[model samples]
Target: MKSNFFRGAVALGALALIPATTAALADGEASSYKALDEFMDVFQKVRSDYVEKVDDEKLIKGAIDGMLASLDPHSSFLDARDFQNLRTQTEGSYGGLGLSVTQEDGAVKVIAPTQDTPAWRAGIKAGDYITHLDGQLIYGGTLDEAVDKMRGAPGTQIKLTIVRPGRDKPIDLTLTREIIQLKPVKWEVKNGIGVINIVSFSANTGADVRQAIRSIDKSLGRKPTGYILDLRSNPGGLLDEAVSVSDTFLERGEIVSQRGRNKGDVERYYAKPGDDARGLPVIVLVDAGSASASEIVAGALQDQHRALVMGERSFGKGSVQTMLPLSNTTALKLTTARYYTPSGRSVQEGGIEPDVRVPQLSDPDYKNRPKFRESDLRRHLINEIKTDNAALEEDSKDDPRFAATAEELKKKGIEDFQLDYALKTIARLAAKPGGAVAQAAPVRKPATH
Candidate 1:
């Protein structure tokens, strides 16, 4: 009798929920139709009564772009040309100025110029605003249009008017376009230390990094004292490449975990059972330009205790973007998930803080140069939990160790002060009786499975 009563109660409860659920769903559909009607009304009116004859395709594209723009800076609608450009970029070769830029209130802002690119050679620092393109005021244009203007034939030259903070005059620069072939990994042995510079995490970046380690060992005829992973001014790329690179150094344990909207929707990546560097001390160098995948690598190594991160705070872009192909020539890049470091730290607005706060005394404008990060962008996702790193910043200020100026550093034959300091620090660690490897060990043991 009790079982029959329970079944009857469940049937009645389900019946009671059906009407309310149906009503709520019907209301939602009605509201959506109403919004669509309003959109269609505006579209029709604009088509019929606009001052100029605007093509339907242009209007539709603009509407789509505006919708995505309202969502987030990273999310966007890629047209045919834009889609092709993205594919070329991930493949590590493109015909452009090699600049990663974003739009802010209609103004194009430089994120970071790729190393060895025309923009980098021209001294276009991050946080500079691009006001004009080729003598035309492009202040209120779309980012796509500005990028299109900057890219052209290999020999073509374009003029740019930049407005940098802490500067009086608007600087004018003339840059020639070229095929930007990105060398994802470049390695060299400097004073018994292996320095590997990862410019961008493009295609095959992981394999390239592994090969770089082999090449460095081959050149030295033995293992170097330590390794410096230079990721400064690197505006991040493929997520898989970042995971693979982190896995190379980490013998085991969780490298990173990404959580989607649902509570249980989580995916974790782990390292295989192999340490490519053989437990050697590693130092990662990052700056305000290091973002996304760069942050992933830095955060992983730092949390895993596999490397000492030395430099300024990273760009703090921790959200994962998934490319949803809409058609053969276009797609929607949507922000899907927020990634966490092995220690469960979200690097969204608060970037990866270096273990050692080493300033770039080599750059003359290091003191005055403004920093651009993910938080500065409009519509950026907010991190609910704030990272308590204010004390870290306070500690770095007025540090006597980094008081030397650019002129003084040049006199000392140190073009890159941060790198020199890192190299010297590694040397000192190696000079210790037990070596750097003894001091450097993973916080957790290798996972058996």
Candidate 2:
């Protein structure tokens, strides 16, 4: 899932809305009195008759947590301190080490350091577990608490002791906090290919991506023969941005659809008329970290056959959240609907499988093992049963064509294997007898950083 490091405070403020209502209804009629009486009765019973003693504050918080947890993982309840952190993140400035850290197997591990931040400059890589922060042991602390300790004012220095997978001993390093302005989208031209790295889908992401593509076109004198969209480690962003990005690539077709409990929940997004790259071959890269909006774009493109999805299966997150406002600058983010690809496939527990599966190349010993085969995956959820009289579609797992494709990918090595395969596939498509260039579109120049 996309890390909410930047929007942590906003989410917290949103959560505070829930309790405000409890106070407003404090002097309600007989119905309200009865409801409160019943609630207290249950609370007393649980406290006395239950197996264990529960702290009042912790019990209340646990109840709130349980309520939010049932909706979706992304929708969370945040306390006042967590709300402040979320605010700091959305403002695009923070005092701490400038690295995204998460709890993994009881230890705090560095996910990725924001580009140009102190953590990135200090050479902290992904998968490094933080053992200590400022001499305080961090092995047992919650990820949120650890983050609170790390964040501070500019010029303040914090020390971190880290343990990497391949390292023998933990390494200690001191870092100074700075104002971190996250540039969510970055682009460049490498070997005649336009490569765009989307770190997160922030508010300005759609514009950033458009400008990046335009800049690459201007620098190259024409659009590149192929484009590589790197969504690795990107936890998703705003839903509209995902739709906008897909719209840029597709000339027409449904991009994504949403279905809620009621008819009002059903909504479909379609692509615009103009094609941004004018038929350029596109390759989207995804991994376990890619979720939500990332999955939307990948699923849409793959379903429409507009791009070749080359990477591991994405982090499955196909739910929609709506933030409801409360009186005291707080809100409640609730899961209102589930989303699906144009092909009507829901990517909930089962994520969007790539057109071509490519394993990670870091391990040499497992290099020869087949990463994923057609038979390995479960049936596509949407295609399993028909609601009305629609024809029953056969599962991709049972199709010979899908099996052959998996076999083809297994023969290729994982180290840059997906990119190599995509390049060859594009070359073959361009060389086809009836294939024709779309148009000679004007190039767009990029602005220097």
Candidate 3:
């Protein structure tokens, strides 16, 4: 009798929900149709009464772009060329000028040239503003159009007009495009301590890292007592590579977890039972520019008490993006979900805080530089919890800790003070009783192939 009553109750509840659910669906359909009608009305008006004639394809694509741009800074509708470029980014090679840029204040600004590429080899510095490509004025044009102009077939030459800070006149350069191959992992045995610099994450980053560690260990002839991981200014890439790279350091346990809009969209990635370092005291370096995959590695190691995270706070981008292909050789790079550290903390607006806050005194513009964070982006998600961090504009005055300018530092042979300090600290830790890192190995260029 009890079973019958429970079944009857469930049936009645189902019957009661049907009408309300149907009504809600009808309301949703109506609202959607109304929005579609409004869109068409505006589209017709623009087609018939615009100041200048516009192509149908251009208008439609522009509409799609504007719609996606309204969502978030990361979400965008990619054209055919953009799709190809993204594929090149993940595959780790392409025929282009080898540059990374961002649109800021209606201008395309250089983020950083890919390491060891034509741009980097040609001495293209970050923070430079590009004014023209091939003598074409690009300020009023779209950034993608300018980028498309910059990249081309191998051995093809292109000219760039650049406006750099601290320069009196615009600089022009004629560069030949080449096949850019990114070497994601670089290692050095510095002062008896092993140091790894992860420049970017790509398809083969994990395998490369494993090989690098093996090579360093073999050259060391013994396990190093200390290791330093440098990830400063790394813009980040490939989520799978991030997981695999984190796994390279960790023996076991959760590396990262991701959750989408739905409650059932939670997924976790765990590390295997092996670590390349063999339980060495590791220190990770980060700054405000470190983001995405780099942040993942830093946050995971920090939460697991595996490494001491130093330098400034991260760039605070914890969202995952999936490149979904569309018709016409186009794609949609959508922000699919939010990622969390093992400690159940979201790094959306509030990025991973370091175990030790070590400012980059070597960055001469640290004080006056305008730092852009996720919070500054339009339509960025909010953090679920509060965070404590250094002030965005601490002070423009010169820091007493670092009195030397770039030229002065070059004279002193201090190329990177942050790396120098971390290496020394690790050396000190290793020097303690019964502990010392391996002797320094000869610095050699890492092989990308």
Candidate 4:
């Protein structure tokens, strides 16, 4: 029988989401006794003749980890601790520094920080490399070890030594841990516009987004001019949540699709029959940190012409991961398929290119900081059909509108230039004679193969 598919999830750090389904074995594969025999021989040799006595469990787990690591960066064997951590993160509250990180060449690199958390408040950037923790060098250590050292009881302080590129000296900062209650969807009225900031796509994110739209309308006493969906620095989460969020604004259309190994093994998600915002103009704001689920939402809106995507190219992670429970306490996060946007675009190495590329002028380091994306990861899945992203690269020369220095913008009381620009753009569109922001044209429904 075909394996039953369900909800999907993804992450840039230690977790990715999907239905808790067991992995299906190959339909026509013979057991390789020779390989099993070779593995057993090595295990016996390590157990009897190694420098020290190694536990069987440790050796076996190591073997499993090595095998998964060889396939791709997203697949891994999750132990008990990792399984628990995944649950906590998906639930949207955890006590830690609130940073999404990944290991590259034995060094823990920042993926992005959860906004309003200790790491973000302390000005930690996406490309920063963490070299030491609490005055002790942590280089060449396991990612889990670094993560364990970083997370602690709430209100406790930890010192981090960061090695940021383009800086002569390493930067040191002490930050206090806090319960990172990830407010997935937050809304406010910005100059007669509804501004919805989605930090992560955790549990109930879609419902929260629908509520935000309702709340915005209620607070304004009428429909707002437009909406700004701020997905900047979001490190992605549940796949179902992404689809739901996309469905909220869409009237009817295919949102996304995931294709597995077999030719006919494909699943497509579609929006239900209602536009929650009543077809209001939407602008999706993304950056290098926007990934997987974030890409899913952005790509859906952009392809359907439901929203104008603004900001840099996304973090390019289009693969879906299935979490198959190995036992009650552990699981395997295996990359099982590649997802595509409504236009059949797989953002594997080439992320969603924004309709308009807006530079972050309020951050002084915008010019020098190198962007990190899924394509940068070791053993990342290669896109068989390459995408030419030369035109999408951020121009070295600044646009006149973005030439203002961070200090200048700070003086003007504009903390976030991207949001500020999006709000104003919506306002301008609303100012047109009819005062009705343009809605997406009706698209032809896609047929499932």
Candidates in order have lDDT scores of 0.89, 0.70, 0.79, 0.88
Listed in order, each prediction's TM-score against the native is: 0.94, 0.67, 0.84, 0.90
Index of the highest-lDDT prediction: 1
TM-score of 4: 0.90
Ranking by lDDT: 1, 4, 3, 2
* Candidate 3 lDDT over residue span 121-190, tens digit each: 7767666788988898888678878887887899999999988776778989899999877678889898
Worst 10 residues of 2 by lDDT: 371-380
RMSD of each: 2.8, 14.4, 6.8, 9.9
Best by TM-score: 1
lDDT of 1: 0.89
Which regions of candidate 2 deviate over 4 angstroms?
Answer: 1-62, 78-91, 101-131, 139-142, 153-178, 362-449
Query: Model 4: per-residue lDDT, tens digit, 1-449?
Result: 23322222224222322222212222222246667788999999999999988899989999999999999999999999898788778874777899999999888899999888999999999999999999999889889899999988999999999999899899999999999886888888988899999998999999999999999999989999899999998989999999999999898888999999999989999899999988778899999999999999999999888888999999999899999988888999999999999888899999989998888999999888999998989899988679767654844675788889899999999999999988888887677775444445655544642
Ranked by TM-score, the better of candidates 1 and 2 is 1
lDDT for 384 (candidate 2): 29
Candidates 3 and 4 compared: the better one by TM-score is 4
Off by over 4 Å in 4: 1-31, 433-449
